[model samples]
Target: MNTESVDAFQARVAKHAALADPARLRIVDLLTLGDFSPTELQAELGMPSNLLSHHLRTLEGAGLATRHRSEADRRRSYIRLAAGALEGLAPGVEHGATRVLFVCTRNSARSQLAAALWQQVSEIPSTSAGTRPADRIAQGAIDVARRHGLGLADLPPRRLDQVAGVGDFVVTVCDNAHEELTILGGVHWSVPDPLRNNTEEAFEAAFTDISRRVNDLAPRVHAA
Candidate 1:
């Protein structure tokens, strides 16, 4: 190969190298679908906050992901995959297959929205579950999805362990759940719980955050 080709090849190698860890891969998978806070990622992947933060920093440094603060709540920040990070990973490949799992304390709001939004935005296979499954999907989540032209009518809550089989990635959408669960197979993202408060304002804020994350993740999931 020419020097230019060799340089491109090595750069790609480094990108994949950064993602080589099973834990880091899981983190990419989670971010591919939505923006998550570091705290939420720690809970979902069941890793120490320090460890999760380290992995996130690595991903950011490698240009595999990006982080931004929520406009509604400055205290909270969300992370998503970097643009074009997944591109050229496979030449001439138009689509890649991926399976994503969204986790939260209750599979009612954030996780539910994530799963539905992934399905709507990309062709990748997706599912949502909770450490503690909710009785039903949160109404606010459903409403927000409807308004956004995404549908959530058929989705039902499920327990995390009930999702049998291998997933390319797993994401935690709640802080407590992210801290509580470990042994998830793939990338871990820490997204805050949207249903922690029942207020309309809180629900709208959660919806906006989820929507932005879903959009950011569509490219990676579809590329996979």
Candidate 2:
């Protein structure tokens, strides 16, 4: 085999080897939906910190997971799957939802885009809201949406309490909203806040992340 093919084969072998342990496999599953701080992951898995660290190192070495410092909190770091690392991996369980509620600290960007994208792929009803509603949607978000053939200019930012109801499947699309809200049965997506940078590139990246997640989730969620 050629050198490039040998390297590709070795990488796949490393990934499978890393997931050989049940603990490491579980960590990948948890990170599939959202980014988690090591502490949060420890809490979820009830694993010792040292062991979790070992697992994280293994996943990183395998090119399956990566770390990012929190934009909201500088001291904290979160772990997430590498982009496209799970392309052919098994999907998570299917679920039922009367409605899908997308949430963020501000209803201006990630959540709004997610709700709109969900509408494109799923028959289930969806809406966007915020923990702390902004007076207006971000112009960056609006422009990105228009570029993607989705409309956000006419949508008003709503508070979570105002729009969310029982039977709604909640998806928190930002770190702040996920950490701030004590949501029952809510899924979290750690899409970075684009308003912090307010650049076209930042907004486009956020839109792409939310769009992929919404598409992945929409098919798994059925109307109840």
Give the alpha-carbon lDDT of every model.
0.70, 0.85
TM-score per prediction, in order, is 0.57, 0.92
| lDDT of model 2, residue 14 | 94
> Model 1 over residues 89-178: C-alpha lDDT tens digits?
422222344677778877888887878877877777778888888899888888777777878747578887787346356767665565
Tell me, by lDDT, which candidate is best: 2
TM-score, model 1 to reference? 0.57
lDDT of 2 at 108: 89
| Regions more than 4 Å wrong, model 1 | 1-97, 222-224
lDDT of 2 by residue, 136-181 (tens): 8899998998998997637789998889898999888887887788
Residue pairs whose backbone atoms clash in candidate 2: none
